[model samples]
Target: GRPYRSHLRPACDACRRRKSRCTTTESSDACLMCQVHGSQCVFVDSDQSRRRKVPTPHGRASSYTESGGSNVDHDDTSISMAYSGETHTHNALSDGQSHHHGPAVLVDPGRPHASAITGSTEEASMSAMLAESGDSNTHIISPAIVDDNEELDSYLSSNPAVGIRRITRTSSTSTNIGPSSRRVLFNTVLKKPLGIHARQSLAASKLEVIEKLLEPHGTVLIDLHTSFRRTYSEHKDRLSPALLSNLYANAMTYWNNSPQLRSCHPPDHRFIWVQANEALHSELFLSPGISTVISIILNVHGRPSTSMFGNGGMVGTAVALSNSLGLNRDCSAWDISPGEKALRSRIWSIVVLMDRWTSLAYGTPLLIHRAQYDVPVPSKEQLAQPNASIAQYAGLSIFLAMLTLTDVLSHYLENVYCISRTSPIDRPPTSSFHLETLLTDWEDSLEDDIRRLVIRGNDLDRAGSGNLRLSYLAVKLLLRRILCDTTNATTENEGAVQARLQTQRVAEEIVLLVQELSHSHLRGFWMPSNGFTLTSATLFLLRDALKTTNRTRNTSLKLAKDMMSSLQTHRVNDSWDLADDCLSNCTDMTDRIEAGRTFESPGMIESQYFIDNNSLMFNDPVLGFASAFDFDLENFQWNETT
Candidate 1:
């Protein structure tokens, strides 16, 4: 077999490096190594190449033809560098052109030109080889192409090569359109705008900012407090005295309507059905000072729109005096430091008013008629019930009035004892709402006030002497203690000490008042003249006082034993029962219907501000009756007198 030599074109450089076959087809780009690696396969430039000097349309020459050559320069093998700024021109040939080359111009390699080259051809042979190679690969892709297909000129405007050539002739009549359109196309793809996506992300970020502004404590506290203030002011002036009388019932309306705050209670007629001390969620009123201010406002102005007490004086007084003494802060009276002068005064002020109201409400008897006003009589069944009406709150009002008085008096006494211990005041004492001055002023007004309360209590007794006696007894004991003598005989250093001593003395006097009430003769059977009796309650009071008072343990014990003895004697005699039935019936009728519970044991008179309800018994002896025949001492059963 003869070797086929002259017709075999030079091998591509890429095929030599990979040790793979080279087709040796002239101007074809594909070689075995480029095909296997899937890399770009292109013609390599050498000294003998005719394609080495192709002109670049732009400023730089094409790397494909940068070197001008004719001889095979095999030894000048410096590694070829890629052109930094370069471009190349490719021919756009029309179909059926006849720039003839041997063997159908075998450029149809199906892949890009291989980089493999061995420079052995002369310059003339290289040109001939390119002609054959270019002719073989050229094809008429679409003969019926329209001129409008060059619309890519608008999209890739600077790259002229990207414009369609239309292939008018199939063979060698091709034009090399400029290469700028490819650059234009690349820039268009790389620098695309993204305005819409950015705007959406920004909008979402703004919404998050707004949500955060509404989340903190500053916003919620401001809104809620403002609402409460607005509500309070709007209704305040509109409340009338008559309306104020039922403020408790009215305040319940506000609590019911607000759903968030409403879960704290069941739907009920009363905002607080249980007693004040028993309220489960009263802490919802969170302000420490709000209750005190409300009390003061009610005390001076009749009632706050939100009050439960129709009249405000007593509640206000209690809050003001208690806050002043710091009693409201601590439930246990014993917790206060004995050395706290201000506290002692406030406490004693409460004690004074409590005592004064008791004396006026309970110590005096009710008159049946104004004509017989100075004279006392048992009020008819209609007039004696406790708290007959809001007007009767005046007895309770007197207790409230004493708050400031007791406060100042206790303070002055402390100071007076402190100063008087060494020397009498070089200056005369001045008056400034002190307890003594209050007592003096009250005394000036007392006759009228006492007359009024007595008339009112009588009016209540006339209504029904239900728990009136209990209220009366409490007020009497309270007032009697206040009237116990206080002296300036003590020196200045002893003023505070004396006030304390005086307070103890007052408590002792109160105990005495209770004992006296217990021993007071019962007009019918064992029904006391006071119209009600609570011998057990008196003992209870003594026991409670022992827990709170600073009195010696022995003294409290002795007093307690004495009260217990009295209770035992009274209960054992069987006479207390004679009055039990009548008292019990009166209590049931009065307590349920009474607007304000004022019934009390004589010992509670020292706390006139309370709405205390004491247990009671009526004066009907069913035990001795033996089927109703042996009783009825008033009517004399069977016309017989025991």
Candidate 2:
């Protein structure tokens, strides 16, 4: 049994974690301790993986290898996470294939590693953050992991060989914070975003010499902020990883910027984008600031060509950050400078845009609802102002147009799309005429830049214009669909008939718009977010096409199929498989000509973003344990399914 001395081979990660003796000889693959416990046999250089010295292929010092072999482990945190199935570990020296040891790291054996970050399933190698910290605030993870903070600390301290103790700190003066802020370790944020994972990876990649790569694409991403020079001048004080990583991710995705950036998405550039996200992931919790919120806004504003519909959590985080920073609240009356106030409004405007887009697409509730925020809309004078940030984000006209259109979308979602209502929803109101009036007025007010038709090459403003139009069309489409879905055939009126015909017409416009504006550039924008409505539109069209055998309705059905074909590009380009399901449903429904056609919900993607569908109608005993309340289900008629 080992005491405090460092072993030649060192202990495997799990064994070292518990400070147990590794009873394996030189010939055994796994030690007796690991084999008996049914754990993997892995080796790692110590000093918190960051300073672990690994020899190069030719037995030379790798440039990345830190000199210190006895540095203190600074990875201590109170919030420890526990994983399921098996103990998972990650190491920084992932690519170093060093079976042979170089410098020996002294083992304190009194403190256990608790900074568990990314856990992987690989048994042969390790990466960053393996062992879980035992922080009480760590919440229960779904399916597998949970934060068993106290239990883990007790287990580590219980070992006779490993006398692990919680690390703590104290301030010399009573100026900084109360006793509560000081812990085993505290985060001291620097002027610049220091110790960023992306910055480290970027340095490791040695991409500074690649100025050709940086200027063409990286510059374009910088311009996205309106004027990078102005943005830089304003913040010339320091750097932020959240902001930098967001730009990197934007260039790497097929969604944002110009075609030039997306087309030149080489393997190396894409790798930086991937690494950028890892950096952003670290920044997600490491710090919270304006740059972090902007990074999140950019992250959700456009997606990587290969990513889809998972930004719900990211959007929620942005909303929380926005509220915390007073982005949702009006800063106009504040004593801040005009530029700063304008910037806040712009950022808040986009946050609202992304929130509604995500909520609509995922069939979820609004994070920042209408009544929740008191921020005022911008005036014509503000829109007319020559601001770099405004221009960088498709000008103020486009923002205003989008802002108004999204207001209508939010109204629809808060009312028509809401599953729960104070009273039964009015399915077919005689009119969505007022909502239509607002939408039409917004479209009419679009300035020359966003209103201009796409004549030639990829005009960035045309994209803004096209996307704005698409948003308007989608709102109009959804409004019409409500009338169509709720109107019964037994009492079919002229308005209901017109609404049905209008549904097909809107689908045609959506498909045609996708064809015209180079849809990939828009990243499927409002079209896909209105997926449920799209499904509803397509199904109703198909029913009319077959039922009446009308050539116009048939043509509408054809357009719906063509639109699906365009969206299919997301499957190949964005790595989303959503089209296959909806497409198959359309095809299968078409094949079964004689199936009963009293249409129900779109049934495309039954997204449970935040609200539980079951909890809305029925109460569960587990959730309401010891409660006498029961839903009167005796009179509730469950729908008969085939």
Candidate 3:
């Protein structure tokens, strides 16, 4: 009545005897699952060594059988020829129907009458043991041939089973940049106990590729870092290699469109990151000098990781290290040399900036508060002015602007947001006038060159200038929302309408600021902060669109759709994902509004359309309930289940 199920590939002996499943795929052996569970894997008969059946065009199935019974890990390199007399013949026995496109299961025929081996054993990088016969003819085993020169990602996608090959650990020091070699090194360091020296050697080998990739941009990456923290420039060579790896990784974020940069940045970023993680642990357990703290900070901003080792944990680690080093105290007046005092101040300022960022990002309380530390802002003397490159002045300007902006954020989060407030947690917010005064004072403090850039929102085209302008707009936007957040009686008043208009104006400014940011260097740097900025602005626009008519429909829809596409392109962090949620809600609102539907808002018919998607504002898998406006929205008190 039904088609026959091919029994060519059988379950392994361990799986059959124990009545469990063996995790074998097209290019791998049956030992993976057993090894994971610390059990021995065995195949009972010769037929069990074959792979599972795959579909053919004629509704028939085909199975590949290896010639020999040994479960050796297959070489992931593209080996083009079979040693049989016929160049295209293979060890596989397929159905009579011709299979046009499929994996070329290259195994030795093991037939006694097969022709003798012809290839010289030529060594390849990262354990790619390729057999090259020195002949000009490249044998075509099947019509569907995977190009030998394809990139690692493409080959791995089509050859999923190749990455699944078990990493056999040996004391061998050689490694390569191929997918299989990376897997081998990953398993060796994680599964097996690799010595520090062996690990160092492996880590050192990974650097060769990085050097070649970065050769075009000499010390641009390192120089940019030195400009930001002149202290780092002073002791640049003294910094450990592990910390340097992390610095390079962060620099890659600025040029994310590059395929090479994307493959090596952070958290789950391959090769380089593994070595960085080791250094972080070693420093954490020990004193964790300034270098380690800098590494952790770079990791925090490079990209957000959801694990405990992510931004939240890294912030805490950096904070603890700062406290231990007495960074919270005013090191400026310390009896130390000018260089040493400036170094401590600069480090503390950056640390405080990140502490606030992670707090907002994770919905946690602020880790650095004024009451806890008396550290003063870094003076220009702290920034390298004497031996400074021309780029140093621009970098130093941005660095100081960031420090002052951190003060503004700290005040808002402490006074307006309440999560970071030194006083009672649920205390009523202070007057918006006080926060505005603080902003005005900070604005006055800005140098002439920066003040000019900060005022004209459209001129914020540089990465530093763009981010700086966005940070300033954030406080202005928050203030407008708070002024407009009112009870039922105030909803229809002229004041409420004016507040919404002002807020809308701020959102429009943000939209202008982000028009060039979709795929630019500025977007890649400080990405999470940029994600939150875009989300807040989008939310405001979507709210305006939902309450208004069809005139603004196209702009809202296009912006949201474009944002969703951009965020999906990188899938960088939880913030991007949350921002996507905001875009999705905007699209849905536009559709519903265009269809002549009137919806009830949570508060006086102006609140967001919190529909069936209950996880809209909060409930991200990693940054749980840490919406773009977590503290601000927590005050809104919208009922999700409703």
Candidate with the greatest TM-score versus the true structure: 3
User: Model 2 has how many clashing residue pairs?
Assistant: 15
How much lDDT does each candidate structure score?
Answer: 0.27, 0.44, 0.46
**Candidate 3: segments with Cα more than 4 A from true spot:** 1-238, 255-271, 303-309, 416-429, 461-463, 486-493, 516-527, 549-609, 612-615, 619-642
Cα RMSD to the true fold for all candidates: 43.1, 17.5, 22.9
**TM-score quality measure for candidate 2:** 0.52
Q: For residues 81-163, what per-residue lDDT tens digits would candidate 1 score against the true structure?
A: 01111111112111111233111121332423222222222212222211211111121122123222243324422321221
RMSD (CA, Å), candidate 2 to true, equals 17.5
TM-scores, one per candidate: 0.21, 0.52, 0.54
Better of 2 and 3 by lDDT: 3
Model 1 clashing-pair count:
74
User: Residue by residue across 337-376, what tens digits does model 3's lDDT show?
Assistant: 3444455576678788877655544556777778777778
When 1 and 2 are scored with lDDT, the better candidate is 2
Model 3, CA-based lDDT: 0.46
Q: What is the overall TM-score of model 3 with all chains considered together?
A: 0.54
Task: Give one digit per residue, the lDDT tens place, for model 2 in 177-266.
Answer: 223211112111111132221213231232332324565555555543433334444343244554555555553433233445445544
Sliding window of 10 residues with minimal summed lDDT for model 2: 625-634
